[model samples]
Target: MRKNSMKNMRINEEVHRELSNIIRSEIKDPRINPMTSVVAVEVAPDLKSAKAYISVLGDEKSQKDTLAGLTSAEGYIRRELAKSVNLRNTPQIRFIMDQSIEYGVNMSKMIDDVCEQDESKAKSREE
Candidate 1:
């Protein structure tokens, strides 16, 4: 199947949803922060492997610990995914830390700060 085929896209979405559910509810690892979320999932066209982009809402240490925990639980997660989604081959999940959400939040805050500064300067000039 082609990489961007409809079937492949469906598979990717299904896997992404299931992975999010599994991570949010199934895993019991202490190191994983409660605020952790699956940002996105990319399954290979051949279904041989997948990349799960994880986002943790916490400090750097928490994020690192969460990734380590997920890495160690890869086998279990794969097994769960297999049971939840019927597929010929359950893709090997590679946990990747996604920083896009955090980056966007920081950018938004910076923009707000700049806007506030500009408004304050305008008010001062008006005075």
Candidate 2:
């Protein structure tokens, strides 16, 4: 299957949804923060391997710990995936730390600060 083929896209979406559900409700590792989320998932067209992008809403330590927990539980997760999704071959999952959400929040805060500062300066000038 081609990378962006309709079938491939459907597979990716199904995998992404199932992964989110599995992480949210199945895993009970303490190292994984409750605030952890599966941001995205990419399954290879051949379905031999996959990459799961995870985002943790916590400190650096928590993020690292969550990633480690997920890494260690790969086999279990893969098994669960196989059970839940009827695919010819279940992809081997690789956990990846995704910082895009955090980066976007930080950038938003900075923009708001700048806007506030600009407004304050305008008010002062008007006084």
Candidate 3:
């Protein structure tokens, strides 16, 4: 009775794979940067709509441009996905920017800084 069953997981993975391929090789939108990639996809239970998480590796301007490009190309992307993936209904695509990778890197840098400071303090204490 659950919608988030194994079937949904397969569909989500296939959709994510197809989308990543389409965005990387097929899409010609000037707004889409080369660094843009599909991070994940979540399809609704009814399969009427799906949310795609995209990671843009660049400055803020490029990220915005890539999002704009993806938003504009939603229809075409859906059509391509439908053609590539066999499903009863093609889900509407919604592009969302994912910045988790950046956040993680920032956090790692902060942690490293703290560790370095602690090491320096230990050295000074010894001296």
Give the clash count for each candidate: 0, 0, 0
List the candidates ranked by lDDT, beginning with the highest. 1, 2, 3
**What would the per-residue lDDT of candidate 2 be over residues 63-122, giving only the tens digit for each residue?**
999999999999999999999999999999999999999999999999999999999999
Off by over 4 Å in 1: none
Shift of residue 118 alpha carbon in model 1, Å: 0.3
For each candidate, C-alpha RMSD in Å? 0.6, 0.6, 1.2
Q: What TM-score should be assigned to candidate 1?
A: 0.98
Model 3 C-alpha lDDT per residue in residues 20-95, reported as the tens digit of each score: 9999999999889998888899998788999999999899999999999999989899999999999999999989
What shift in Å separates residue 91 of candidate 2 from its native position after superposition? 0.5
Evaluate model 2: give its lDDT: 0.94
Better of 1 and 2 by lDDT: 1
Model 2 TM-score (2 dp):
0.98
Candidate 2 ranges with C-alpha deviation above 4 Å: none
Task: Count clashing pairs, candidate 2.
Answer: 0
- Model 3: how far is 58 from its true place, Å? 1.4
Q: Candidate 1: what lDDT?
A: 0.96
CA lDDT, every model vs. true structure:
0.96, 0.94, 0.93
